[model samples]
Target: MSTDTLDLDDGTADRALLDARGLTLLVFTSQGCPNCRQAREALPDMNLNVDRIAWVDAGRSGGLVARYEVFHLPAMFVIRDGVYYGAVQASLAHWDISRQVALALDGYPAELP
Candidate 1:
């Protein structure tokens, strides 16, 4: 199934998260980052078990960047039913991303930052 993606900024991220249902892939990305571009391209086709993909431009979303402690481009976090799960640690490969997301969801939900 095709997953929906919402472009978010610091002002809108929280509201989007609050409104999100099911699994949400919250990603911090930069426009100039090559890896971020690749992530943008790969994520839509990854077939992730997520209801939506929330894209936050790190360069412009200072609040979210600091809150999430994003240290690199294309940082990904998993959220379910408006609760924060944890960061997703995986390569850009579809299978790897899917595997990592599953592993992260199995862990306890983290306190939102």
Candidate 2:
């Protein structure tokens, strides 16, 4: 997948994780990762209707990792009103990435999974 990575040291602002007017979804993935591939495929079908931005870095870029407080690869972060809402993984049998986005838009707090 194509990625748009933000350069943190250039003094540019990190993309707001949440937007008060609407909600956003940020799915962190890496090349050559299988689980990330499955998540990406299932994202559209899930309840989360979000503007997806794919981050290419998998911890090698400190700026990118710290930008989102990412602790691991193949992770997900959902945001609402510029605040973090949720995260999902392939291991979550009951988890659907899109549901997190939908729930956030429906007035749920930022609930990280």
Candidate 3:
């Protein structure tokens, strides 16, 4: 449950939502990455749900960065139903990334009771 890494226990970003099927944005960030810092700052202002975002520190875990094939900071991967759904690469504006995230969430199927 460390804040610096993705919670991979049940493949859910938030452990409390392990049984909740929905879209998750696995955001990979690194130290000294300006773009990543910017994205982090803007994310709290976005319309995204708190549980839907996973802020992972890539610099702290090289294996994670390699596993996701991420070659840049502030990389975002969408996961739905415990599967890879989409990705938004680096070098893009925070607004653009937020838009992509919204689109991804729009496509997520509603969870069943």
Candidate 4:
């Protein structure tokens, strides 16, 4: 992983995602961040509707990181219909994030909910 900081908010960063007409979960991460690496890796296993964006713009990554309070390297959230479900961290699990998505859509109100 690149030990480089990231820059979000740029038109060039790869907008890789699974998007729809509704709710989205924004995962803020950098390749150097182990946690971020995990989340990005596990994404393919979770059944979700999402629009994933990689913030490679090193200039604005810090501000975006602070705005989301993403003090950790790897982070995730449960966005429902379209709202902040909060972020969390875990070592690594195949179903951990999938479960979060389940609970979120099922009205779990999120961890912050």
Q: What is the C-alpha lDDT of each candidate?
A: 0.89, 0.50, 0.60, 0.47
Off by over 4 Å in 1: none
Listing every candidate in turn, what is its Cα RMSD in Å to the true structure after a full C-alpha superposition?
Answer: 1.0, 5.9, 6.5, 7.4
Q: After superposing candidate 2 on the true structure, give the runs of residues whose Cα lies further than 4 Å from its correct spot.
A: 1-13, 16-21, 47-56, 59-61, 86-95, 98-113
Local accuracy of candidate 1 as per-residue lDDT tens digits, 1-113: 66999999988888789778889999999989999999999888878778899999999989999999998889999998888989998899878888888998999986667
Which of 3 and 4 is ahead in lDDT? 3
Return the candidate ranking by TM-score, descending.
1, 3, 4, 2
Assess candidate 2 and give its TM-score to the true structure. 0.53
- TM-score of every candidate: 0.95, 0.53, 0.63, 0.53
The superposed Cα distance between candidate 4 and the true structure at residue 29, in angstroms, equals 1.4
lDDT of 2 at 33: 72
Candidate 3 per-residue lDDT over residues 1-113, each given as its tens digit? 11222334223334433343565667787769998888777665565542466677876766667767777778887666555555664345556766776676566443311
Tell me how far the alpha carbon of residue 83 in candidate 3 is from the true structure, in angstroms, after superposition.
1.3
